[model samples]
Target: MGHRHKNKKLGILIFLVVCVLFLHYCTIHDVVLRHAIYRMLFFLPLVLGSFWFGLKGAIFVSISIIIPYIPYVYHQWNGFYQEFDKFLEAGLFVFMGCLLGYLSEKQQREQEARLKAERLAAIGSAVSQIAHDLKSPLMAIGGFTKQVTRHLSIDHPDRKKLDLVISETFRMEAMVKEMLDFGRPFQLQKTEENLNHLAAECIEISLPFAKSSGVDINTEFDPEITVRPLDSNRMKQVILNLLTNAIQASSSGKIVSVRTKREKQGVALDISDCGCGIKAEDQQKIFEPFFSSKKEGTGLGLAIVKKIVELHGGHIILFSNPEGGVTFSIKLP
Candidate 1:
């Protein structure tokens, strides 16, 4: 990564220096009378470098051109009336260049962070699946070891040692299964399905858990709305993930709702939770993998939902409500 960044910086600086030379020579006929275009030229390297190759690239461009600017500066030094305007032009050019470059770098950093989160979420999901799959076998191993221990003589130290081995193996196996589940990728197959039907199924499965947590879920959807292409199982997962998250996030006596409608350009699936909304700083990271509000959450649920939505060529947008809740919008194209 460092080498690639260094190479990108080198390439951009070279390109910017070439631009500066071309601009300098192109205006040679008007050398004695400095032109506004030259001031504009001052930003060519900095702006281009910063916007594409980031801050380091822009700094390199700036350093490369700054030395050349000195000769031009000295040439017009004696013109008393023009000094202020000349300095102002230079300052503004440099400031805007650096500012734009910094902003570009910041955006790239944010995007990179999102990608990292998604990868971790994917890992988490694999872990969850593996953990689920291994529970029965691990249980059997532990149970057999326990049964065998009771049959052995109380003085049999070897029996107890075997039980310890069984116990440790189960623990290691559980961790291995979790790692597998979290590392696997999801496969989505879309078919036309009722949005309301999917939501109902998810709610039914999670209803018992939600009730135990003292949360309520409600849904309103068009009964005969035109069916759109969707992956029923995956959509069920998405609904359950979102609804489960909503229920877990909601405080005692809070309610969550699932609603759908035909909106301009696409169909909309909205899930609103009257729970404590996400913190302002965490809103953007909410859909990122391994990022969660719940203490026990693995954080892959929402990340998988986002990936599924995006795979369907849909948009998932979230925001905090003034009512101290959260509104999630998924628009599928």
Candidate 2:
């Protein structure tokens, strides 16, 4: 991950350096190469940067090129309005960069969404079949273990081991449920519900476990937010899974903060925890089923969360800090 990041930074630096050098050369040689077409050549790199790095990259490269070209433009004309016209020309360049960069980003995102939908469609079928096949056997095992425990006295020699077996079976059952949940087609039964109230319910459910581990749970819901149409049950599941993961990630006395806010685009829910943060490489794989960092983790929690968010025409963003903590923000429209 470090190597990849370093390489990306190097590439951006090299691009900016080359662009700056070209602009400087043009400025110094303006007498021989000062055609209007020559001044407009800067847009080539600006467009390329946007396609390569997105809006901010395009704007940054535009500003870098404009700085060198400004002095040349100033030396060409002495009138006050002429200087203002040059600034307007520079502003046009900036606007072009922003527009092209935004379109390129939007296109890239659409392509990614198409690819993700295809992948999910392929995987969901196989997972559904597998979960269906495994469910019956797991239920049988759980039933047998419970019956055995009922027969055995609490002081029986095998009682503790049998109890452990029952617990393990229950855990397996939960995993199976998650598999089915992720594999099946989800249809949101939307109704008007307050996001803050849903969050409070999730917090209430997770509070006991948090307190047991000496972790603190905090909430900050926007007072101005009102009831909005959403899938109450599924949204609640998303909140609970996030809260549970945060609680599990933190150590004693660490704080987990959950917040909901109204944004111009939609509603946003942020779940953050001061815990042992995720590694850079692992962060990308966290949403892949069965890719877990924990000894007994199912790794389906976040995957399910992501699927649900996407189903609702929303997106999830992960901000991971290895030294500090991680935050998962879900935006629902």
On lDDT, the candidate that comes out on top is 2
lDDT per model, in order?
0.75, 0.83
Off by over 4 Å in 2: 1-112, 321-323
Q: To one decimal, what is the Cα RMSD in angstroms of model 2 from the true structure?
A: 5.3
Give model 2's TM-score versus the native structure: 0.70
Candidate 1: Cα lDDT at 29: 40
Query: In candidate 1, which residue pairs get closer than 3 Å at backbone N, Cα or C atoms, i.e. clash?
Result: 123-182, 125-181, 125-182, 126-181, 126-182, 127-178, 127-181, 127-182, 130-177
How big is the positional error of residue 314 in model 2, measured in Å on the Cα after superposition?
Answer: 2.3
lDDT, candidate 1, 18-111, per-residue tens? 6765566566544645556665666766777887777766666766776776775676476757677867776676676677778988999999
Give candidate 1's total backbone clashes.
9
Q: Model 1 segments beyond 4 Å from truth?
A: 1-33, 36-40, 43-181
